[model samples]
Target: MPEKIDYLKKIRELTQEYFQISLDDIPIPETELVNIEPDRADGLLVGSKEALNYQYLVQGDITPFLNKAPEGYFLIGFWGHGFNSYGFYYSRVEPNSRIFFRLPYGGAYMNNKREAIRIKNFLINFFEFKNKLKTATTFNVVESMGEGFHEIKYKDQTVKFKGSVYRQRNPEKHFQKILKSLKVPTKRHQHIIKLPSWAGKKYEDMTPKEQEEYQEHLRRKFTWEPGDLKKVGHEPLTEDEKKLVESIKKQEEDVNKE
Candidate 1:
């Protein structure tokens, strides 16, 4: 609780330094950001590794919040791990006309409630200035793991905004990472299917019903059993697996020959 407050204070200080607005000038009162535990209603597994927290500050109305937020924000209430940080949205009305900004994860570690208030004050000023800016400027310092800092310039001033950075993790190269973190078996690799060149020829020659039957057979044989693929130390390949691999090789060979 104290940590949350400290975070608010820091945000307020940053806002004041950048935007020249104090906590009192901001119309909305600071409220505690609450941690909502993931539940079945949220579509999260009972013991999933991810967690979510949300905070809202309303000023004038509720209509803007609902209509203006991006699709991700709407989906936010549904999943836990998709987003892993704390942030706030400001509204001019009871529940509408709001803009949201996601804060870095560590921002939640403020000392006390009063400090959190200060941070909120800082954010409001920063955002207000951000909205008024005309050009963006890069910051000399780097903050989070994948985040970059930038300053946006307005006619009379500039405000800083944090940028998110994402890195692609390869599942094949980091199989251990995926396997170690798995709560349940992974889904089968339907994306990459190996079919023999002869199989394609046969399919083209088959009747529609025969094609349907062939497709069903493939699905039944190749589709993985739930939770089977996620296990570590799984064997190299079974007889069926070998057949699939051979078909894939034949297809590749045909393409190469062409």
Candidate 2:
């Protein structure tokens, strides 16, 4: 626990130095854990009559249903802990994926206090960064500060068909539309708990181009791991990503000036 606390402390220091956001604008969670699970408690997710973003700024660390974290990020906020550029409060303080890679290793703790010499580790792994830098760089957040959706696009790379059949991974809801039209079947699917009146429409209702675009723009809505895309080669930077990174850097410089 002591080492975990130290690593968390270190995370805060680096975030403050590079995130370039005003600390006052982003308050920290009082502790590493939320007062309670937001979903389990009423009003935790909906909050008061304040703006959704304002509520998150005031109490996001405890809410999960309304969370808009960077794609592929675990963001310790679930446990009320903050790391990298994230504050425990759930606000996207300095939304940079690079902040996640900044941790010395990863996870809640490093080592256990007991054991002769080996001292077994927790988190099911040693709680270290094996390839956090590489993985973190493969994705970026759409915004550093937003009370809205935390949109994320996965970095894509072109791969030649080498005649080796590749197993498929789960695709996003929009992409599933394409598969549905193609008559492909899958046990897994994007589950929408709530359905609006328009939900009555089926995949046949979508135009071909719309379906294709949805599939083409597919992205990850969950965490990333080395095994997930280990074989995918490097992707050339998309024009949008290049621009976003530049804008982030500019903001960093501006914050440094202050």
Top candidate on lDDT is 1
17-102 in candidate 2: lDDT tens per residue?
A: 43332333333334342222343322221111222222332233323323443332233221223332322222222333322211
Over the stretch 131-186, how does candidate 1's per-residue lDDT look in tens digits?
33213232121222233343333233434445432112221332233222332234
User: Using TM-score as the measure, which candidate wins?
Assistant: 1
Instruction: List runs of model 2 lying over 4 Å from the truth.
Output: 22-24, 31-64, 67-258
RMSD values for the candidates in order, in angstroms, are: 22.9, 26.8
C-alpha lDDT of candidate 1 relative to the true structure: 0.36
Q: How accurate is candidate 2 locally (lDDT)?
A: 0.29
- Candidate 2 has its poorest 10 consecutive residues by lDDT at 158-167
Q: What's the C-alpha lDDT at position 40 in model 2?
A: 32
Question: How accurate locally, in lDDT, is each candidate?
Answer: 0.36, 0.29
